[model samples]
Target: MLPLVHNELYVEFNDEKQGPFYPAEGPIPFGKFRKHKKSSVELKADRIGELAKTISLPRSALSGINGSDQALLAQANIVQMEKPKSMPFDDSPFLQSTTFKNKLDAKTAIADYLGKPLSRLTDLQIVAINMILDETLDKKTVMDKIRAYFTLSSAGHSGGD
Candidate 1:
């Protein structure tokens, strides 16, 4: 979701397994966006996919809770509903990770695989580019080849776990 905002103009529908899309180009990697500072929370590896569920028990679900417990629950509700403050863009791993290179090498390779030129891509066609890159980086595999097989296969198909 971090990279999604930067390339929003061109790749509004990135499929994550690939990268953003340009209407003229198709799925490509994180290209050189005019503005490119992306911000995201860095959760520990141990907490990667853990969903924030069952963190607090509902008043109805707990029969023995007293008035103080109910007050605490109300306070918790307020905190949970408040919009979360975002961290600084420089805090993102993309700035330091080897997988998050800013150069167009990966983007060019992805464009070649998709049979499209980078500049020709419009503000549409690409979908979920960040997700694709994130998943690819996690797997330690080749980015272009991975994108090639998926783009050559079918529309709406994803290689993500």
Candidate 2:
């Protein structure tokens, strides 16, 4: 039996030299492929710009383009063609730092303090706790609200406790 091959094509409008992605199958039609490629590149560039802004990184770090939409689109296409590998969280020194570990421990501590099963906590609750531990929220105020929501009477009254 012939193995099923997935036809994946990637293209970039900005840097035509970087790619004509054909991961599994043969080359894609240049005309239709270019249109989709350009749109994808634009979207990726916009996303990278937004992320850079959030992290306070220089825009150039995320996008090498200036004010020109054409240039931005081109750079994005080059990036897509490069098919950069995603950095694993475990490999990031920031994520592995003592401070980060302490914060993670604090989050786990909060879950333990509430006596609520970790599985029972909603995604929002987990995010809230992490945010609080990171000082993204005022600890005193956020803890009070969390305690009230969980109906936790005291620090030691965890369900398991």
Look at candidate 1 and tell me the lDDT of residue 19. Answer: 43
Segments of candidate 2 deviating more than 4 angstroms: 1-101, 136-145, 149-161
Best by lDDT: 2
TM-score, cand. 2: 0.24
lDDT for model 2 comes to 0.61
| Candidate 1, residue 74: lDDT | 92
Candidate 2: pairs in clash: 14-74, 115-159
Off by over 4 Å in 1: 1-100, 118-125, 136-145, 148-161
For every model in order, what is the number of clashing pairs?
A: 14, 2
* RMSD, every candidate, angstroms: 30.6, 23.9
Leading candidate by TM-score: 2
* Residue lDDT tens for model 1, 1-161: 45643433432335535445445544556865554434455344325546544267767667665777669989888533556899767766665555535435556566776677755543433444444554564323546545664565455546442
TM-score of 1: 0.23
Model 2 lDDT per residue over 36-133, tens place: 44588899999999998887656755785455765767777854356679975676655543432455555565666777666776686667666666
